[model samples]
Target: MTDRTYIDIHVLHSVPPSNLNRDDAGSPKQAVYGGVRRARVSSQAWKRATRVAFTDELHLPAEQLGTRTKRISSLLARRIAARTGLDDVAAARLGTALLAQDLNIKAGKKETETAYLLFFGINQLDAIIDLIAERAEELAALADDALTKAVADLPVREQLTSGHPIDVALFGRMVADITSLNVDAATQVAHAISTHPVEIEFDYYTAVDDQKTAEEDAGAAMIGTVEFTSATLYRFATLGVHQLTANLGGDTNAALDATRAFLTAFVRSMPTGHQNTFAHRTLPSLVSFVVRDDQPVNLVSAFEKPVRSRNSGIAEESARRLAKELSRAASSWGVTPLAVASVYEPNSDQNTDTLAAFGVPHSLDEAIASVLQAVRGRLQEPA
Candidate 1:
């Protein structure tokens, strides 16, 4: 039988205490789920920002993820048709018709609608630019005040024109689905951390916009000035041992090394400014190391919390304590074949309290590097 072990890389967020109800603006300082109080993170606050950051990493277009496909699609289609000299009904029909047809189906059915809406929105934008340029001389011949209003109202009519805005209609729909943002509900994040794998390429437009968005908007009140432009992103995915092995002709060790190399390279090259967080977010607190051997099953440790929770010196103390505990687990079992798994989490009050809830007495001092080595030795010992 193949041996398997589960590991969790817990992230610790330093949150201040608060008194708030479920319906309040603030997140729950304490709330119970599955018969235990969970350390709550606000959906609207930093958590949403993190989700957006990861989403950015995934390189999936906003249309493929967010839930506001229909609205954004309508908006984009209207923008396009108004410039093209189409009426409201025609614009809506053009957008909706593209969504129902091949525009969405080509991107894969996973988030077709959202993708279609996004495509339409982007196309609409292009069409709007073209229309504005095409009509500039005509509009300029009229009064200046009249031209401004004419340009503003132009988008509402350009939605028709059969072939133009289809891509925006499709792509916008995709963004709405993935991001869960729609006209009816305000956008909110579900968690502080989320992980997903994707294939992405360098998108210069997205990069430029990201840099621009970070700047204070000096032209917010100005007419016909630069505005927020969603940037394109590139994604690099981390793989596990099994995934690595599968991709590398079934060589487990090579897979591990490949995974490690990829991760190391990606992390090393990540931009420093991208690391800033809105709420004093710390770097990743935990690192998981997987070990596998030909040992028998049913010898796993009952305790799962990898980090020690106590005072300032929790890491060293937790490492030492885990080393001792691991030795005991190995000795109790008559056979030891071969795996050592080490999990780490930052020593934090919430995490410590969580370990306590699990009936494990852990302190910060236990997380020393020496302790990890000692525990690894015991777990890897051959019988």
Candidate 2:
């Protein structure tokens, strides 16, 4: 069966549907993009909030979530053992040991933990007891023969020395697998570049305006656009059905099941702004997965920034460059899905020319709504 699995995510500064020129806070009263100033936000603030949300939900590293072995194993073990006959001590021992062995902790001070884990994972004690009970009749028959002797032959660590390492790779341990990461990024990007954008009401002087006249008058009033930094990102990851199967103890079926489950859970749980986490508003419709890096594709990450130049539209051009790099990265990893990141500055010029000086070009104000749609269309088409 075809994997038919890929993700398309975008992040931006803010979104406002209409108007031109922002106030002192760097938000758009309105500006021009896609040949018109629809509304605007900044990319940096969106990414920051979204990143924080993800870290909190997954207990991920302060910087990145969804890729650490310890975090995944510990989380998975607890989930698997829940309401099962297993106790906490047994479960922890199983999880920690399995993770240690999977990471290839051969010999060291940590070997104690590793050995303990291996024993629990294989359930040696239970297996030995069961075997002894089942073979009682055979042993009783052999007792009449003086030449026969009984000896227990329990396997030591040497028994598996010649065999390949135990499989311990669990899925859903990275941002890629956490579908919300992509969804949130896409949602943030949409918010950054929308036609009518939402702004946070942090000013104490501002009163709630529910009246029709107040609403009408609010159009020209200055407001704060959500701010955040967005970088051109390029990401690649591979799911080695073969290596994965070996890692899961040669159970191809189990590997496939786990992969499917992980992918589904990740996508379903993706987080976004104040609302839903996995907002599909800016998500691309079609996705493509290549066997290697270098395929011609249009989606990328938001981490990498391009070299600056004197060009006026360098930000969008940088996005194009990032798309190209994304294609290359996917081609480099056999059967992996990779994304590219394009830097975007949603608001007007700021005190620091960080993004502008770095060479990321700005977009026409209306470009936000269409960017994800355009990228999705490109990926959905056949090669």
- Off-target runs (Cα >4 Å) in candidate 2 are 1-168, 171-235, 259-269, 276-281, 293-383
| Tens digit of per-residue lDDT, candidate 2, span 241-354 | 333344344454454543343222222232233233113223211112222122323333222332343553334444344444444544664433433223344344332333
Task: Tell me the tens digit of each residue's lDDT in model 1 across 108-175.
Answer: 34432333433233443454446554553355444545544555545433332222221111111223
Please list the C-alpha lDDT of all candidates, in the order they appear: 0.32, 0.32
- Angstrom error of the Cα, residue 107, model 2: value is 24
lDDT assessment of candidate 2: 0.32
Candidate 2: Cα lDDT at 29 = 35
TM-score of 1: 0.32
Model 2 lDDT, residue 379, Cα? 28
Tell me the spans in candidate 1 whose CA falls farther than 4 Å from its real position.
1-38, 42-50, 55-72, 75-89, 100-279, 289-383
lDDT of 1: 0.32
